[model samples]
Target: MEALTGCTRDELIGAPFKNYFTDPERAETSIKLVLSEKKVTNYELTARARDGRETVVSYNATTFYDRDRRLQGVFAAARDVTESKRVEEEIRTLNAELTSANKELEAFSYSVSHDLRAPLRSIDGFSQAFLDDFGSTVPEEGRENLERVRRATQRMGQLIDDMLLLSRVTRREMHMQETDISALAADVTGELALDNPQRDVQLTIEPGMAATGDPQLLRIVLVNLLGNAWKFTSRRQHAHVSMGTVRDPEHGPAFFVRDDGVGFDAKYKEKLFVAFQRLHAQEEFPGTGIGLATIQRVIRRHGGDVWAEGEVDRGATFYFTIPDLHVSCPVKGKQP
Candidate 1:
């Protein structure tokens, strides 16, 4: 208190207490309030030091009485909070600046992606038209070159669409609720089967598996994981894919998508979830290399983590956990 007022004990002992504060009227009223109400806490006041330096302080006071029950006076203590207040203001300003920057970045990404799509569509359309109109006149090499142009345009269009989806993953609002993991896996696998009717794929999903999260996002997670599993297992005469949950000692209940397919090196596991990072050749697995990154973003938004375990040519398994969301189901035995 003496440091805050910049006064010696001798100089302050007989001085009027309210005179040391910038607002003498408020300071006097605070003391009267403590007398009537018995106590007051965290009453903000600006204390003017002897040298005219002002400091923001929180005053806590209580009424004191004599042993005979006669009202004596109010005793108060003030703590300097000027530095803390300054830090709080700085934090608020930084948060506002960050929010503004993110909004601008999202807008820029959307505009660029939207602009690129128009030219890509035009290129693909013109290339197809040329092949149809001048197929006999063009040499064999010229026809193949036109086909390559169309393919490149198609791939570029997919990449642009994926980039936009990735951006939306961060910007979209989440609606959390109880979602059935098994049902979502079933739906995705059914679509995969219809798309690749020739492939013989065996899919097993554990029953009654559920979690609390955005149903739409969770379905996307299944689509990407199961779709990758289905794609990579294309070479196998008989492919096996499974989905289930297991209790991880560190992460609690965890969900997984496992497949017996042409897997990747374990060393490149970290690269799998990074956008545009590919382990296999584009010819071997056709993708925009953005699926795993999208899955990571969606899982993280729900306070979860996603990881992969794989070995060359053996298989791969992806595990994700949503902590604090009651993600679990009763496993009777091993899933067939």
Candidate 2:
């Protein structure tokens, strides 16, 4: 009691216990409960120190009996829980603040998607109308300038759409279950092949590669990754793309998408996952630079991480791990 209350043991030996309580009425109620129940486990109260500082304590108490079995007094032991209570309060405050911030962000994203895109549509529409109605009457240079303006507005519309998708990926709630990753990858690749049948790309997907995650979000991950691989390998005479899983000693099962295409420099790897950050020129490869960032958010929400390895002009391999899915062996062929 002396160590907890900042009072000397000699001064507290016969002092009234009620005098040390911050709330005398509450302390009296707790005493009554202990007396009636014959014992109290972890009853909480605030005790005032000699210097007027208050400390929260959890007390375990029981009635002390004399030799004749008559109740004499209460015997109790208290453990200080002031620090733990403070930590719990801090956590609650942080959670509330985070929720409020996410709501505000969602509202802002909605405004950008609808309000801003309306004017952009008007700009692109009028530019197209000018070219269609007065294209022959206008000079060649003037007509090309109108075409440039239309293209710029179209690109701006694309940027806005991608930004909304990135925001949705961050705020959306996930539904976790078993997902067929191999089939998803194959579907995305098939779509790419159908869109550009002229390109001859050899895609090898390890069959039956499975994991536990949000099936929808994981599909988005495969689309972006495989889409990038398809786009970058467009110039290759024979493009080679593969999707499979590997066992890592430290990270457990890791999935990868590898492509033999135009790869980026290792020095710029850190910027690969940042929104609006592009390592390659727009003229070389067209992208709004939001795909990898969206993939990173989805993987992180599932308690996983995504990374890449590549050398200039060689190829790139993207690897991600879902820690929640304890997948050990390969679904088909031997591990790579």
lDDT of 2 by residue, 171-255 (tens): 9888889888877888889899999899999989877778899999999899999999998888899999998887656566789
TM-score of 1: 0.85
* Tens digit of per-residue lDDT, candidate 1, span 301-331: 9999999988989989998998644434563
Considering summed lDDT, which 10 consecutive residues are worst modelled in model 2? 326-335
For candidate 2, report its TM-score: 0.84
Instruction: State the displacement of the C-alpha of residue 229, model 2, in Å, after optimal TM-score superposition.
Output: 1.0
Question: How many clashes (backbone atoms < 3 Å, residues ≥3 apart in a chain or on different chains) does model 2 have?
Answer: 0
Q: Tell me the deviation in Å of residue 200 in model 2.
A: 3.3
TM of each candidate vs. truth = 0.85, 0.84
| CA RMSD of all predictions | 3.0, 3.3
lDDT of each: 0.88, 0.88
